[model samples]
Target: MIQILVIAILSLIAQLVLPWWSLAIVTFVVCFWRSSSALTAFVYSFLGIAIVWLGYSLWVYGQTDGVFIMRISQLVFKANNAVLPFVGTTILGGLAGGLAGLSGYFVRQVTGNQSMSHTA
Candidate 1:
């Protein structure tokens, strides 16, 4: 239906526009269409995407920067380290990506039943 399409677009927008809590709105909308169970599906989707993002970041950092995570870990114990800001930024980026994934998951879950069905 048109409503589901609109919701899917909005969810994609939430991922594109916001970083953290992107799914906050989309989750509510999906719940309206499905139920709270859809929220769990969204979380799983977010986690799956977040893991991929994290792995990609780690790989890139390893290739270009070398031992970035080790340096970050050391910075965590050392309060005056300069890498703190970099680590903080990385966390924020991850949050954004996670939110986007959450939005995607909810959109799929909400629309799955309607769109995936065979209508004669």
Candidate 2:
């Protein structure tokens, strides 16, 4: 469908230009608008990811190198505070776009049938 195609293309663009939250926005949109089946898929996907992340956390909690790497990365990004406003704006914009798309999809669904006019 054209909607899926457009979402996929935008997702790829977001991956290149945005942070991890952009992917979350995509997931939310796909889960919300595509179908109930897609919503279930999203739930299962998150469940699987949670399991994997929990396992990895338990396995790596004692690793010294991971801690050192995390600390260094934190130091490197400490200056992010200076640009927090820009980062916040970018995140909010992506969220707004995703929600707008979802709303448009639902609007089409509701108005698709003349019989559904009352519901709309």
Candidate 3:
């Protein structure tokens, strides 16, 4: 739980200060340090990024009345509903973070780290 929070906060900060892909890098590094299982890392990272993206999207939607997003959505996806693009954006961000987290776990495994252990 705490680990997920840490990853989310760090990823958000990095996203704000760095480029778009910073979230993936931050998630990768954090997951690598935490030594989580691939599935656990992916799920947690996906949730963290999805939360951040959705929150930010909502904030932007509130700020601009979502006109720009709606237009872009229409142009790119032919989406009529404003919410659909937001959902797609969140899912895309989650997928990126999840893949990065999974890659981190794999890197750890390749480097001779102990396999992630599950506990009940």
Candidate 4:
């Protein structure tokens, strides 16, 4: 709940200020500190990144009337709808965030942190 919100907000801020991969690093650090289980970390991080990306995409779509994104969507994915590009972007961000969270959990496991539990 609160943790997920924190992850999302921090990751979004990091993404805005740093490189795109900073979202993954932010999620990794946060999940590691929180000691979340792999599944919990992945799911929460995915949700956070997906939500932020979708919200940002929607904001951009509204601001641009979908002209730029729609063109790119058509060029890359051959998508005809104005919304498909946003969906694709959200999915991509979610997948990357999920993997980063999983990697963080694995790092904790390999280091013998032993704090992550099924209850997480």
Candidate 5:
């Protein structure tokens, strides 16, 4: 829960000022600092970023009256539906966080610093 909260908040702030890739950095650092296992790191990171992205996309859709995401959806996915783009955005963001989180977890393991060793 803490990992999810930290990653989601940091990722939201990061996205506002930084490039999209900053989500990976936020998730990686959060998991490295708090994750208890590989699965926990990946799942929590995935959920955090996915939730943030989904919410942000919804906000943008509302603000732009769905024009922005709809166009993106058609251009990138050859679809006319907003749902595709929403799901795609969430999944992609989650994937970036999940992979970076796994990397962080493994690096922490290699360094033998299981600071939060309790199971999630």
Candidate 6:
């Protein structure tokens, strides 16, 4: 819960000024600071970013009446389905954040920081 909220809120705010890759940074730092396990870090980070992207994409889809995404869906999928783009966006964001969080967990392990955390 904490990890998800922190990553989602921070990455969302960071994306306004920082680039999209800032999501990676935020997830990495959060996992590095405190995560029970590598899987937990990845799962929490994935959920966090996925939720943000889902909401953001939904809002954009509504605002533009699906014009932008419909064209993208047609181009990429060779069909005009808005759902494809939404799924792609959410999955891509989640994967990026999960991988970054996994990296953080591994790097922290390399630094011998595991002793500080009481893993479940």
- Evaluated with TM-score, which candidate comes out highest? 6
What's the lDDT for residue 109 in model 2? Answer: 58
Write the residue-wise lDDT of candidate 2 on 1-120 in tens digits: 333444555555665688734645654555344533423333433433233333334344346535643453457655424233334334454444445454434554565532322210
lDDT of 4 by residue, 69-93 (tens): 8897889888788777887899999
Cα-based TM-score, every candidate:
0.35, 0.29, 0.90, 0.90, 0.93, 0.94
**97 Cα displacement, candidate 2 (Å):** 1.1
lDDT of 3 at 19: 93
Query: Where does model 1 exceed 4 Å of error?
Result: 1-36, 67-120
- Summed over model 3, clashes come to 0
User: Any runs in candidate 6 off by more than 4 Å, and if so which?
Assistant: 115-120
Which portions of model 2 show Cα errors greater than 4 Å? 1-8, 11-80, 113-120
lDDT of 1 by residue, 1-120 (tens): 333344345555676678635544654444334333444434433443344344445665668665665566566755545355455554554455445445545565656654542221
Q: What is the Cα root-mean-square deviation between model 6 and the actual structure?
A: 1.4
lDDT of 6 by residue, 27-64 (tens): 99989887889899999999999999999999998999
- Worst lDDT run of 10 residues, candidate 2, spans 111-120
Query: Number of clashing residue pairs in every model?
Result: 1, 0, 0, 0, 0, 0
TM-score of candidate 6 relative to the true fold:
0.94
Two-way TM-score contest, 4 vs 6, winner: 6
Model 5 whole-model lDDT (C-alpha atoms): 0.90
Q: In model 2, how large is the Cα lDDT of residue 58?
A: 37
Candidate number that wins on TM-score, 1 or 4: 4
